[model samples]
Each structure stands twice: as structure tokens, then as C-alpha cells.
Target: MPAPTRALLLIGPLLLFLALVYVLPFLGILRWSVTLPEPGLEQYRAALTDPLVRSVLWRTLRICAIVTVLSVVLAYIVALIWVRGSPVQRLVVELCILIPFWISVLTRAFGWLALLSNRGIVNGWLQATGLTSDPLTMVRNEFGVVVGMVHFLIPFAVFPLASAMRSVDERVLMAARGMGASRARVFWQVFLPMTRAGVIGAALVVFVFALGFFVTPAILGGGRSVMVAELIYLRIFQSPNWGLGAAISVLLMLAVGAMLAALLRQARPGGGS
Candidate 1:
């Protein structure tokens, strides 16, 4: 076989799988988005103008942004520590990070609810210690949703960054320090720049995952607070509006695509932290 044909033959199965599983379903949702509810961008219009839908969409994006920021920052610190720390320290911190990922998402959400609820341990301790006159609302709100999502996303952000940080050249760092560069300057100029692509990639992965998150927001956010994913669920399962649900799914995919595109654009050239 010709070289190009051989390469295509090798890659064709995986490409076919992606088309069957991901691309086709995505395109189907895009079709549904247009066809649902009398067609012609009605769902898109509802997504923008309807007060409830708009509020949920805005809240979801805001939470995803906050989670992405916090996750990236925390992951950067943790990744640096992992790269530099003693073996035992690295083991402990890595395990601490992985433990959350291993735990079921539902269990994690339930644990957050237990800790943050009115009569839960956190509030109980606060009341006993005179931190407040009464239990503060924590779970079943925006705060709870954010807390859970951030917890879930930190690992997603950290793995990429840690892998990148591990690949950094220690000799370069030492050389910078030897040349009289301050610790802060060395980190900002050398270390951060080297890890920039991984950071952007990690942020993109976390943000996109957070965009379609359902369980964390649903369980922690209560019925009052709705995310796009939960709204999609309501449309499909609750109201039996499959078309509308598919339309929202398309919007979700588009939102995620926009984030990926932005991150990719920033990733080009010499972009860094």
C-alpha cells in the first residue's frame, strides 16, 4: 500500500469510531436544536431571552469560570509541589488528589451535602464554637454547587499540569538561579512559560467538563438553582420535549467548542501564564 493510504488505513477505524459515537450524536443534537419547537432558532432565542433559561445559563457559565480559575491555580501549585517535593511528599499529595477522583461523584456530592447542611458537621461545629448564632446555609445553593464542582475538577486540571511540570528541565531552573535570577523571577519567566500549554489544556478540559455537569449541580444546587445540563434533563425526561433537550445539548456543545477554540488560540505562539 502507498504510505498515505497505509496511514489512512491505520487511522480509519478510530476515526470511524469517533464519527459513530461522538460526531454523529453531536450533529444529531444540532439538527434537533433547529427542528425542535417549530424550528428557526426558537430554542436559541429561548436560551438567550427567557429569564429562567438565561439565568441558569449565566449561572452555569459563571460557576464554570470560577471552577476553572480555582482548579487551574490549585493544580499549578500542587503540580509544582509534586514536581519538586520529596518522593514521600509527592506520594501523599498525589494520593490526596486522586482519592477524590476515585470516590464516586454521587458519593462526593452526598458528602458535601452532609458537611454543609444546616445540621451537618460544619454547621454544628460552628454553632458549638460560637462562630455564628445559627447554622449558615451552605448546601443546596450556588456555594454548594461551586464547592462540589471545584472538588471534582481539581484532579482534572492537576493531571495535565503535573505531567507537564514533570517534563520541565531542572537544569534550566538551576541555571537561571545561578545567573542571579530571583526565585520568583525564575518561576515566572522559566517554569510558568514552559508549563503554559499544559495549563491552558487543563483549564479547557475542566471548563468543558463543568459546562455539562449534571449530578454535582443537581444534588448540591437544589431544585431552585438550575444548570443547563439539569435543564436539558428536565426537557428530555420530565417534559418529554426531546427536541428541546437536544437543542440545549447542541448549545452546550457549542459553548464547549468555543472554550476549546479560545484555549487553542491562546496556546499558539509563546503564550504562557
Candidate 2:
């Protein structure tokens, strides 16, 4: 076989594995969405025009946006400190980020629930301190959802940003300072520009993860606050509308794909997308 053919043979198993595990399953969902209750566009049409669907989609987008913003900013700070911190500080920071990853998502969500519930510690403390007469509603709403998502996503953001920051040259910052550039100037001109790729990659990862988030949102968001993933679950298992569930899932995948495509298209070469 030619060199290209030989290479293909070597890589074929991996590609086939991905296709079988991911692509085929996804396509099966698409098929299910279109096939049930007769092979037609009705499911798609309902998914598009249904007010409840639209509202859930909008809420998901809004929460994702909030989570992305919070995670990115927090990650940037954590990454900056990690990259510039002393050895002991760096170790502590890394551990702080990694420790949460070992903990289950449900565990983290419940922790937040304990902290934010009306009669929970946070509210109890606030009331005891006379900060407020009533417990602020933190959990069981958008506030809870965003908080849980941000907590879960922060490590993802930090991983990429920290990786990117590590690639930045320390001498470059020193050189800029040596050349009489102010600290702010050096950061914006040198550090920020160099870390652009990592930041974009991190944001993309966080946003994608946030889009399909189920457990955190389900536990924190309550019934009134529903994300698309939860809605899809309700449609399929609770209501037994497999076709509609599949359609929603497909639409979600398309929406995520479109956003990622737009990010890639719009990003500059040095910037991560």
C-alpha cells in the first residue's frame, strides 16, 4: 500500500471507534427525532415554534453565558496567580483546582444546596448576623444554577488558561519592564496577547460543557427553572416523547456546533477558539 493508505490503515481503528461511539449514536438520535409519529418535519417544527422550548433554550443560553463569564474571569485570576506564584503557592493553587474535580458533581451541587437553601447555613448566618431578616433565595433558582455551574466549570477554565500562561515567556515581561513599560502596559501588551489562544480554548470548553449540563442544573434549577437538557429528559422519560426528545437533542448539538464554528471563524490565528 502507498504511504497514505498505510497511514489510513493505522488510524482507521481510532476513527472507527469514534464513529461508532459518538457519531453513530448522535446520528441515531437524529434519526429517532425525525422518524417517530411519522417521518416528517413536525417534530422539528414543534421544537422551533413551541414557546416552552424557546424559553428553555433562552434560559440555557443565559445561564451558559453567565457561567462562562464568571468561570473565565475567575480562571484568569487563578491562572495568573498560578503562573506567577512561588512554588508553594503554585502547589496550593493547583491542588485547590484539582481537588474539586475528584468530588462528584452531585456532591458539589448538594454542597451548594446546603449553603444556599432558605434554612441553610448561609441564610442562617446572615440572619444571625442581622444582615437580613429573611433568607435570600439563592438555591432553587437561576442564582443557584449559575453558582453551581461556575464552581464546576472553574477548573476547566483554569486548566487551559494555566497551560496557556505557562507558554508565555517570563523574560518577555521582564524585558518590557526593563524597557520602561508600566506594569499595566506590559500585561496588556505582552501577557494578555500571548495568552489569547489559551483563553479562547478555555472559554470554548467551558461553554460547550455548560450547554449540555444536566446534574448541576437539575438539582439547583428546580422545576420552574429548566435547561434544555433537563427538558429533553422530561420529554423522553417522563412524557415518553422519544421523538421530540431526540429532536431537542439534535437541535442542541447543532446550536453548540454553530457557536463553535462561529468562534473558530472569528478567531485570529494566535487566538484559541
Candidate 3:
């Protein structure tokens, strides 16, 4: 066999697996969006024009944006510590971030619920310290949802950011400092510009991941702050509106694709997008 043909045969099984598991299911979703309920783009039209759908999309985008921003900020801090701190501090911080990876998403979501519920540990501490008499409403709302998402997404943001930061030539930083640049000036002008790609990459990743969240939002929001994923679940399972659910899923896929495409288009071989 020719070399190119042998290479293709070597990866054929993996390609077939992806086709069966991913490609077929995606095509099924696209088909349902147009074919069910008498077809002719009704579902797509409704998805675009319906007020309730619009509200849910807006809320989903808004919550995801918030989670992304918070995750980036916190991840930047964590990544900085991981890259710049003493060896012991770096080990501790990295372990703390990675520990959550071992825990299942469902477990983490439930853990947040246990900690953030009105009568949970946080409120108990506040009350005991005389901070407030009434229990604060934390869980089962937008605030709780954002907190859980940010916590879950910070690690995702951190890896890309840390990679970006590590690739920076420390000699450049030294040169800037040696040239009489102040600490703040060095960081704001020299260091940050070097890590620009990482920051944007981290933010993009967090935002995209947050956009499709289901379990955490469902558990934390408790139906009060429904996002796109939860709404899709309700539409498909509860209301039995598979067509509408598929439409929303397709729309979401498109939105994510657009972001990824824009990133690819703007990204350079050596610089930030």
C-alpha cells in the first residue's frame, strides 16, 4: 500500500467513531429543526422571533459573559501565582485548581448548593458574626449560578493563560525593568501585552463553555434563572417540543461556531487574535 493510503487506514477507525457518535447526531438535530411539525423553517423562524426564546437567549448570553469575565480575572490571578510564586506556593495553588477536576460536575454543583443555600454555611457564618440577622439568599438564583460557573470555568481559563504566560521570555521583562520601567509600568505595558493572546484565549474558552451549561445552572438557578441549556431540556423533555429544542440547539451551535471562526480568522501564528 502507498504511504498516504496506509496513513488514512491507520486513522479510519477514529474517523468512523466520530462520524457515528458526533456527525450523525448533529445531522439528526439539524434535520429535526426543519422537518418536524410540518417543516419549512417554522422552528427556525420561531426561534428567531419568539419573545420568550429571545429572553432566554439574552439571559444565557448575559450570564455566560459574566461567568467568563469573572473566570478570566480569577484565573489570571491563579495563573500568575502558578507561574511566578515560590515552588511551594505554585504547587499548592496548582493542586487546589486541579482538585476540582477529580470531582464530578454534579457533585460540584450540589456542593455549591449546600454551601450557598440560605441556611447554608455562608449565611451561618454571617449571622454568627452579627453581620446580618436574616439569612442571605444566595443559591437558587442568578448569583449562585454565576458563582458555580465561574468556579468551574476558572481552571479551564487558567491552563491556557498559564501556558501563554510561561511562553513569555523573562529576559524581556528584565530588559524593561533594567531600562528604568516602574513595576506597574512593566506589568501594564510589557507583561500584559506579551500575554494578550492567553487572556483572550482564556476568555473565549470560558464564555463558550459557559454558554452550554446545564446541570450547574439547573441546580443553582432552581428554575429561577433558566439559561439556554435548561430551556432546551424543558422544551424537549417536559413540553415535548423536540423541534423547538433542536432549533435552539442549532442556533447555539451556530453562535459558538461563529466565535470559533472569528478567532481562527483573526488569530496569527505568533500573536493574539
lDDT of 2 by residue, 1-273 (tens): 799999999999999999999999999999999898779878999998999999999999999989998999999999888989989989999899989989999999999999999999999999999999988999889999999999999998998788889988889999999999999999899999888888777888899999999999899887768999999999989997898889999999998898788567546564343
lDDT of 1: 0.87
> Cα deviation in Å at residue 63, candidate 3?
0.6
lDDT of 3 by residue, 1-273 (tens): 999999999999999999999889989999999987877799989998999999999999899988988999999999999999999999999798989999999999999998989889999899999999999999889999999999899999999899889999999999999999999999999998889888888888888899899999999999999999999999999998899999999999998888777556545675453
Candidate 2 colliding pairs, count: 1
True-vs-predicted CA distance for residue 90, candidate 1, Å: 0.9
Highest TM-score against the true fold, candidate:
3
Model 2 steric clash pairs = 197-272
Off by over 4 Å in 2: 1-13, 259-273
Which candidate achieves the best lDDT against the true structure? 3
Compared with the true structure, all predictions reach lDDT values of 0.87, 0.90, 0.91
Worst-scoring 10-residue span by lDDT in model 2: 264-273
lDDT of candidate model 3 versus the reference = 0.91
Candidate 3 residues lying further than 4 Å off, grouped into runs, are 263-273
* Comparison by TM-score, 2 against 3, better one: 3
Q: Write out the backbone clash pairs for model 1.
A: none
State the lDDT at 115 in candidate 1: 96
Structural RMSD, model 2? 2.4
